[model samples]
Target: MEFGILSLIPPIIMLVLVLLTRQVLLSLGAGIVVGAFMLNSFDIVPSFNEIWKSFSQIFYVEGDLQLGSIQLLSFLILLGITTAFMTASGGSSAFGEWAIQRIRTRKGAQTMPGILGLIIFIDDYFNSLAVGQVARPLTDRYKVSRAKLAYIIDSTSAPITVVSPISSWGAYIIGLIGTIIAAQEITGYGELEAFLRMIPMNFYVFGSIFLVFLTIYRKFDIGAMRKHEEKAQNTGELVDPSKEVPGDLNNEFKATQGGKIYHLIIPILVLIVATVTTMFITGIQGTPAEEEVSILSIFANTNVNRSLFFGGLFAALSGLVLYMFLQGSKSSTGKVVLEGIKAMLPAIYILVLAWMIGTIIGSMGTGEYLADRVKEANISPTFLPFMMFIVAGFMAFATGTSWGTFGIMLPIAGEIAATLDVAMFLPSLAAVLAGSVFGDHCSPISDTTILSSTGAGSNHIDHVMTQLPYALIGALAASVGYVIFGFTTSTILSLVVTLVIVLVVVLLFQPKQNSIEK
Candidate 1:
């Protein structure tokens, strides 16, 4: 089987299996197996021989494995270990208990997660997992729906990351922007410099973040999420198990303490500070020192991962120390940390599988084939960005992985932008990032989606099902914004108009009330 037709086979098989059985893991596994079988179909004996070869090539240092696969696996494992360690130390639970003490009203309960999500914009991965973990209990305490919590977490993750100039996402986007400019033969425009110039024009990123804040602070509800919220309020049902903490209602206030809140706040603050400092020192945007000391050189010299690994390690350690010092052994800090790690096991497993599947897809040359087909289509320059956005969205959704989407889209988008003279550079780059985020936000297979559910203690399917409508609203808004920016003279106006329309729709429809009941 040629790779092109073989590529279609996995998704088709996955779709049929998923629809017939509704088992996500089984579907994903079948897709992986199909991809592997396709790769080995040329020769049974040689293919079986190559299976171990392929696996080792992808997993180990040798072979023709994709570097992105290795980076993703390393990051996921580190993330899992860090998350497990943090929870094991009791920091996550302590934060939740602390937040619950202050959230008395229903509105406050609902808004708190949004606020936390906004503040944790240092990294999307951090923001998605940490906010979900800390806010779930508080949201549950006030009878807030699990779907709502997942929505807040997912909405905040990619949107905030896109806007934050200091994040890992920022660095990646800036690099892509540079590639677009260079490919287009644009002179005198540095990568970071070009990105900064386009910041004002990156309306979707900023607008999405602003819309999230509005949704929370203004109590705006839309689509299915509104329906869920209303049902929870009417029935007083706990939609999420993580929301159910042990102990009686009358004694809830008595269980609260001022010091518990500080434990949560301080560690988060440390992580943020560390992230910023690391980026700055590394000169992610090419510091003046880059003339003599390259960012890559600095990273290689300092063993940066070790620093982040230890930084997270110390943050967990400090949280435990505080727990013991303040609670005087009543806190069971060690037990708390242990439980947190145990809690994250399921998410970790899912992420590992996702990475493996992504690796197989990459190894099979899917991205190159897709890019070649796209190039042959000869799309118009004016429609390029909009089309790219749609294509990227579909690819990410199909793969259930945004980073993988970027890995495939960035090079193609850069090449396309280059071919279109210089006029389409910024718009093209924006489309790729926006599309990747759109799929990640909506896809049930995404790591962020799984993590959000894990953090909220909600069923993964329920989170995916409930969050889809709201995500689509944002995607529609973004799509319109992309079209206007891509093809028209009034890019900023298009963005503003699109955002305003989406906000109005959300406020008016208010889906939380209706969706939750179903």
Candidate 2:
């Protein structure tokens, strides 16, 4: 069952195909076939049969891997509907008009998406879609490149969620920690406290946020991003025309003449409230009414899929009602909602493909193979955190799933850290979290990355290309920070050193202000 070197072939093939062809769907499909072939001992005919068999059973109640792929697809569909409703009702325009008065400069316009993305910390999916829908108009008005907008959305989504203690990412990581603690039988350790200790040690998220700010304030652009920004400024083309542009919700909606800002604000508020409230309700679904529970317990126990689905559905329905009121036409509102769902059909296909590939990768024991390779390296305890960061990043980049990387790496890191002399556990654990985000940020097949492009209406490959250098910068700085923490074990010193490194890198790559045409 252990495929060893063969396990690495699928992801490598997928990445190569994506870079060469810039076709996500084709590349993912090819990867799945290749993985299936490998699983079937190199029988090409059976590979085709095996892939369909496994993919169809993705939602089957046979394994713990049933991630409710349909539920996630529905959540995305609902979010798309809400986004369409907002745009169609002119709520987005109203919000943009309201925001433009307070945020006049291009930098502020570009920076606000990051700020918005940061605060929408409940789920990365919501953050990516909502931030893009709200900020695209503002950014376009200022000639900010869609690539940059996509970068901000993608960066802030996973990075912010990884560090947020209340998010789905947080719950997953905490669950991983709980399993580790229980399996290792490590006494005197609480999952909450352990996760809290890793917060400052999560250097990648901090470093990524800092890099976004640097880009916003200093106008630093390197590699493809610089060219994208320059083209946007010179031609006023917010998106790169050389690449295939993804479909957006804009064309589906006819913005009303005098829509109020409440149309936008109220729906978003309802969505957030619904998501949070549903999380609590689901968290206590099985508990007795007399039983007292903590918020953390609720978060830990909540059904994330149901919460996101209901939250997005409620918001979409609310937006539909608001649009109906504003336009005074039920048919028109219904039409916009349908069109919104249509707009997201491509994204839905991409999400489904990503999930399909993810399942094949897991079935191949790809994570286990990669982790075993790292373990065989016989890395020293001091270098474990740094090495684990690289390992986790590579695993995530290859697999295009940070959660999968966490599943594969966290327990290994925790088990190894348990035997260490000092408190290396936190740093090692943080390394896994940071590295996972770094890889996911750069990966073309990543769901968040794809959704960011879809939301910003940018070219998928362009977003990946422009964002790669920035993500690499953050990853490199975080790697160095992990190394420092591995040695010094001082959170403050490590962060200071990491931030300084990031600043220096930014300054080195900082584009000339005059060249940017402020």
Candidate 3:
């Protein structure tokens, strides 16, 4: 049952195919088949069942459609329609025209998405989708490549959420930490305190965030990102003409005349407010009567899938009503809705395949096998954190899921540290957290990366290719910090040094400058 090293082949094959073919759907499908074969020991009939059951489980449970997948898909369709409605009503165009007067520089335009990503930390999915709606027009007007916008959106979304205890990711991690500590019977600090302690120790989070701001304010791009930036600036093309970009509906719908900035602003505001309120409500409802309701309790218990669905519904309806109020039946109601749904099909297709591959990868035990090997590593306790960071990064890179990495590696790291040296516990776990983000940040199959591409209207592969060098730079700096942490358990020293490394690299090594003026 334990395939060991063989578990790695499917994801690796998938990654290779995606890079070469630039075909995500086919690559993901191939991964599913390969993993299925491995899971079934190459028995053809059983392998086919493996593939069918993996997909069937997503939509069917006990003869009824599964609520979780249904809710998520509904949200995507609604969000797509909401985006379409904004365009059809001319709200998007109006806001762009309005912003051109105030925002005079490219950096100024690019800065807004990062700032918005920081503000919208409630959920990464929301942040990825909403930030694009707000920032895309501005960034496009300034000729910032869609790939660049995606990197900015992605770098901030997970890194911010993973660190902020109020966000969904923090809530999940805190719950896991509490469970691990309780099971281990080692408790000097509670879950909240433990999470707070790890925040500063998360070196990659800060390194990646700094890189994003530095790239925007200081003007730098590495690897293929430079080509993307140069092309965008020189030709006014935000995306590669040859590559397919989702969520970009060009000339498919006309912008209504007499559009106002408020038209664009209100629907998104409603969505954010609605989603947050639902999270709180679901959190409260899920809590026990005896338990005292608190901030931590709210987020930990909140139903994220349900919240997104309701939020998307409310936002889409608001957009529709507003469009009708303005256009007064100028465009057929069905036509606008259809266009919006059409724009989001590419996103939905990519998402479903990504989910399937993730499921298949989980079954193949790719992450678990890697974790087991790392668990068996015969290394000094001082290097435990560094080894964990590297292994966790590779596992996530291969499997395309940081949350899965956390589930598999955190307890193992906790157990290892508990057995070897209790002092290494936080450092090891923090390294896993940081490394998971770094891997997820660089992965082509990562959901956050995919949504970022959809949101920014970039070719998915371009976003992955452009962001890899920056992610590696941050990972290298973070690895050094983990090594230093191992030798000396000084969070301040390690974190500051990691950030300084990023600063020096950016300030000293400028990739050949593009023609964009300061």
Best by TM-score: 3
Q: List model 3 lDDT by residue over 139-203, tens digit each.
A: 98888999999999999999999998998899899989988888777878988899899999899
**TM, every model:** 0.79, 0.93, 0.97
Model 1, 78-162: lDDT tens per residue?
A: 3444444334334445666666677656668767777788777656666775676567657766677777777778777777776
> Each candidate's lDDT (Cα)?
0.62, 0.82, 0.88
Rate residue 198 of model 1 by lDDT. 56
Candidate scoring better on TM-score of 2 and 3: 3
For candidate 2, the TM-score is 0.93
The sequence of per-residue lDDT tens digits that candidate 2 reaches over residues 1-518 is 88887888988999899889878789888998888888888887888878876677757646555665667778778887887777777787888888889997999998889899899887787688778877887898788888999998998989999988888788778878888888777776688788888888888899999999898889887888888888899888877555555546545446887677888888788888898889889877834467667665676677877887888899989998888777443337668878777877877777777878887888888889889887667678888889989999988888888988898899888888887643787788889999999999888778889889887878888899899998998988988888888788789998888889999998876777755466
Q: Between 1 and 3, whose lDDT is larger?
A: 3
